[model samples]
Target: MKAEKWVFGFIFVFFLVVTPIYWFMSGEIAGTFVLGFSALLGGMIATYLGLTARSFDPRPEDRDAEVVEAAGPVGFFAPQSMWPFWCAITVALIFLGPALHQAWITLVGVGFGIWALSGWVLQFYRGDYKH
Candidate 1:
């Protein structure tokens, strides 16, 4: 995490320095926007790492340990289902709607997408997998 923080911090600083230099050299608004946005992204990553570091101790990966111990079982993982396939079909419809200029199809796609996502999220809350 500390290494991640430093890497992002370096990127942030690099962008900060390059943005002005790029603007002065090219005088292009688009270049400045790109550089500024990149800097903002770097800052966001660094900030997230710093906040996360505060919440938990360093992990074996973070410490560069020669031999890391197992962290133990993670949690229950949901079994595979068909929701993703449905979601993909919905996405295809949504993209196709815009290409064919049909608003109704796009609306239907969005509705179905939401339903599929909801079903996937609650799949384990009932039936055989219910805890």
Candidate 2:
């Protein structure tokens, strides 16, 4: 936690110092704003980490711990599924349709988005995972 705080703090300061120099050099508004926003995000992360508890138990990297010490059951992770990918495609189509001036594609995307969302949500309920 300490290391993370310092790292993000460095990032925040680095970006803060560079944003103005970049803006002065390039004379661009968008990139300058982006850098400023990046600095803001980094500062927020560093501040949050600083305010949180250091931790009751030290992390593995913080101590002289072996790989076997850390090796254990993590938790349940989802098995392979393509619904998320399909859902992303549907979102792209939804936005692309308006950008391209194609209403039909947007409608199709909406229909598919519903299917994707429901399929992802109910996948285990109807499948082998059901009990």
Candidate 3:
């Protein structure tokens, strides 16, 4: 935590120094605006850290909280999925077909591609019976 504070402080100060140098060298309004906004952000962040550091508390109950058993098993075992391979083929077809100017073929491939992709991805989230 102390290291994190020092790192943030170093970054804040480094940015403060770099921004002004960049602004002066470039003589651009955008650079100045960026510098100003960065300084404001740094100040706000420093203020937040200062306040949080001064007000932190350790709770005994939180330190030694009780663990509760879950009502049931966490997840179901999903069946093997082959649709991912099919979706990959369809996606390849969609790209190749369109590049070859086969509009109808591309459209059909894209539709099936989306369907196969969703079915493949969502199979894991289904109930045991569905899987």
State how far residue 85 of model 2 sits from its true place (Å).
3.9
Residue 90 Cα positional deviation in candidate 1, in Å, after optimal superposition: 1.1
Tell me each candidate's TM-score.
0.78, 0.79, 0.39
Ranking of candidates on TM-score, top first = 2, 1, 3
Instruction: Give lDDT: candidate 3, residue 28.
Output: 92
Q: State the displacement of the C-alpha of residue 72, model 3, in Å, after optimal TM-score superposition.
A: 22
Alpha-carbon deviation at 72 in model 2, angstroms: 0.8
Report the error of model 1 at residue 39, Å. 0.8
Report the alpha-carbon TM-score of model 2 versus the true structure.
Answer: 0.79
Off by over 4 Å in 1: 64-70
CA lDDT of each prediction against the hidden true structure: 0.90, 0.90, 0.72
lDDT-based ranking = 1, 2, 3
Model 2, poorest ten-residue lDDT window? 53-62
lDDT of 3 by residue, 11-66 (tens): 67877888878877998988777877777677667767666765765232324534
Give the per-residue lDDT of model 1 (tens digit) for 1-131.
99899999999999999999999999999989999999999999999999999899787778766553636777878787888898889999899899999999999999999998898888888888887
Clashing pairs for predicted structure model 3, backbone only: none
